[model samples]
Target: MMFDAWLTFAVIAGAVYLFVTEKLPIEVVALLVLASLLALRLVSTEEALSGFSSPATITVAAMFVLSAGLQRGGSLYRLGELLAQIRRGWLLALAMMLLTALVSGFINNTAAVAVFLPLVIAATVANRQPPSKYLIALSYAGQFGGVCTLIGTSTNLLVDSLARQSGEAGFTLFEFAPMGVIFVAVGVAYMMVARRFLLPDLGIPEQSDTGHAGRYVVELLVGEKSPAIGRRGSELLPDDAGDVVMLEIFRAKQPVSSPRGEQVQAGDRLLMRGEWRDIEQARKKLRLDYDHVARDLDGDVAAERLHAEAMVAPGSHLIGHTLAEVRFGHTYRVRVQGLHRHRLAIRQPLDRVPLAVGDVLLLDAPEKSLAAMRSDPGLLVLGERVQERTKLGRALLAIGVMTGVVTVAALGWLPIVAAAIFGCIALVMLNVLKTEDAYRAIDWRVIMLLAGVLPMGIALQNSGAAAWIAGIAVDLVGGYGPVVALLTIYLLTTILTEVMSNNASAALVVPIAIATAETLGLDSKPFLVAVAFAASTSFLTPIGYQTNTMVYTAGGYRFTDFVKVGLPLNAIFLVMAGLLIPRYFPFS
Candidate 1:
């Protein structure tokens, strides 16, 4: 191998490591890949920058807006409301899966799940069932539906774009439908049987009679006689108490840099967190003075301070930063009392707890603050819009535009990019969505990720590295026949997708899949299909898919829950791909 090839491999290994550890955000990792290649002069600047202009990138941004339009205009929410009428548990689960899968085939999977999530939880609680029984199924169904169409996921379009760049006629809108439908059929049925045996009843979350459902973040003033003065912050709350944590100590009105290690002062203002009842107990036991926020809650029988549950919205800026870093209480004027992450309920020291999508926060927010939080676009305060009459005209228009977008692209009236872009324009012009809402609807992180990672594929091809790796793969498995090659590629893509970004896995593997096909003197379509399908089927863990992450906290599922349920499903997919992909698109 040439030095450049070796260098590219090194870059690839570094990228894979960073992506798996998530030591940095995905877009940051992607830009690093681009910068490494540029600094090494691996590809021309044009080729490196080409991803920003890629059809896949533009189409994906447009799809985000379109999906947001559907959600905003109430096309999805109105449909979701009907599930509330379901009388049986099995029927409710089945309907949630079917509807989410069907909707996901056209829109972004994350958006589909986000719209239906509260509804799923509500219906389950109403029926006295654990949300655990149905939430993972909802996440999986979104994946099932995503594979059914070209526009369903950015990954599908990305693979198509990569294939087109490789000099092949790319896939059409429904080219993926036959296989996707098969995945949906196998998945929905498998979850139906497996959930009963494999999923545990995590139970419904409890709410406080005070209307605050979680822990409280409050500021306490140190009294002259308080024993807490001169005590270290860590000692403020004993480990066994599990009730209160001193997040920060304001010494003489200025925050000490390290709250825990810093000793408290006589006049320090301490920011503490725990359940309301527990916090009250601590304040009394410690002889502390309560701040006005506390007194407001203490004396207000009128309930002017509203308790609402807010979820970190998908694509929210709050994903990685801790609450203290965001100055959450000060910025939003809400006191967070409780937080649920994955399957664990965090009760104290919330300043260090970073937020992620689907993390539900129990908040004691002023009525005015609740309005600001609702309109912030980064938080989904449940029950805020439950009764807003669905916009009949705008809903129909949004539905019509989305349908037209899918139909035109399917009919070859325009490329998927043109159709999606025009559809976004139509929605804004028709007032189904506001212009600013249309722009806000797009997850720019994904756009930047696509723009940055697409060039890594270019680097692989241009550096002769993809061919070098493809030769090695062909040498190891080529003699075993093309079926073996197909399975090998599928497994490799699946494993990578489980740990890293799906689109990144596709961007990296598609070039190799194409290279392997050319080396073996076979058609690459089936290989590309294997990449597309494998990349989309990320069922092995909570963090692999955004929808999975959302449901992780909402469902109260442990890591092994996904493994217990998704393991058999993954095997079924491997078998399905091995048996069916060849039949659908043969190696000639």
Candidate 2:
């Protein structure tokens, strides 16, 4: 028993290290923990593989699909339209945080944050305030609301699932809200108070979007004697016409979206937009025989109508591919005009820069093609999603289905797992999310991580490691009181969460929390509650939460920015949890 206990301790420590280092995919590390626990004979094979079929894992996956359906329904986007009307930057910022928290409590917080990301950016641009001021607050708001409901965040469900496995009654949907609301209130108030002094205004400027006042559309034919015939389309604009945008090329009356990798040929008419002087200068620079069929040419002003923006979807196949390599123009039927990464506008050739998940591309495609762009999962077009009458109807239905799922589960008409599963089937039949989109909506990495880590909790308990650790923790803190023991659990969970995946942190700490409660002769619910709140509220670092990581580059924030902004929020959460956790979930 002692050997097994020590071995369990070693495996868990190694797993924690791997999670912190992130040298392997988090899911892979989870699988390793399961494998090690079993191979070391710490857990039976059934126990080792049980997380895959665990209720927590399945519900997490189902919630992901449910969240996708609601997101597709355009409800959040509609809400954003209302928020946009608040012109005062500070209030607008506060409102954004509030809405994010509210929406997140019902669905996946990451999805909630994602839906609001572009809206926040647009609102900031309109108000002429830096997005960085509210982006972190927006991320923190997701956590705030996430803890309010059972289904709000996967971490909540995960801890609930673990608690249920220990023979405790499953938590109701709103069980966490009493304390969660306190946390949100405190966090939001902190944001409002600290906004001016702490929130950094270092967002990346749109350097690619220079002056537009003097530019006009013009078409130039690559004449037979033109030096541009054999070169790439981008090279056609000489230094004098550097601001000119090559929108398209027509050869034999066929349109190409800027000849990405193809050589320009004579008689290929280049569709471009720039200042008339630059246009006239480009015409002279091109050496085209303008006295012939092209002499009576007059330019049209149409480029602005064709330009749009799209972001590379997270986990997109296009993340590492350059524009030329992906044949981006041909594949997506859109011309790549420029790219923004993190906060820096790439002034280099677009052909060489590799795409990343958050990369925002300035594209020139026809209106019809822009509509088609939304169909590809690899890219998310940034702006207000279409609210066409048909889409709005589907969105409404999607909203209804999601509400039913939450209602039935909350009222005990069905287990959350069952209600959620039925809700997903209804969503498909109702066509809110297409079959493929439903699959895409599930962040399988998280599902796999849950499946992979729950078993570690099982192993920890089976090997007597939990009791040993719990005894030590209680011995150190028990002299103070049960409240102090609760605080110890909360603080340790909080520390682990700041360094590793929150789900994993919750999984590892829950069994220890149960053991600690037993050692102290108290109810485990408060300890469990401490674990849930602590694991979910990671604000100390960008990597501590996925939402924070998403907005890191977009907001153009520094590493210390998270520390500077998140420290106070973390303090607020700690204080709130310490006071209210025992109050709501008494330590009897």
Candidate 2 lDDT, 157-181, residue by residue in tens: 9999998988876689888887788
Stretches of candidate 2 above 4 Å error? 203-330, 334-371, 374-378, 381-390
> lDDT per prediction?
0.83, 0.78
RMSD to the true structure for each prediction, in A, is: 3.8, 8.4
Candidate 1, 1-588: lDDT as tens digits: 388888888898999999999888898999999899888888789988989999999999999999988887877878888976796999998988999999999999999998888787777776777778888999999999999999889999999999998897699999989878988998999989977888777766443233122444666778889988778887777455557766778776667888888887777777776756677778888888754443333444565777677889878878888888998887887777656555444433555677767777777777777777766667777533343357888899999999899889999999989999999999989988889898888888899899989988888888899999899999999999999999999999999999999999999999999999999999999999999999987999988888888777666577898998888888999999999998888898
Q: Candidate 1: TM-score?
A: 0.88
Evaluated with lDDT, which candidate comes out highest?
A: 1
Instruction: Judging by TM-score against the true structure, name the best candidate.
Output: 1
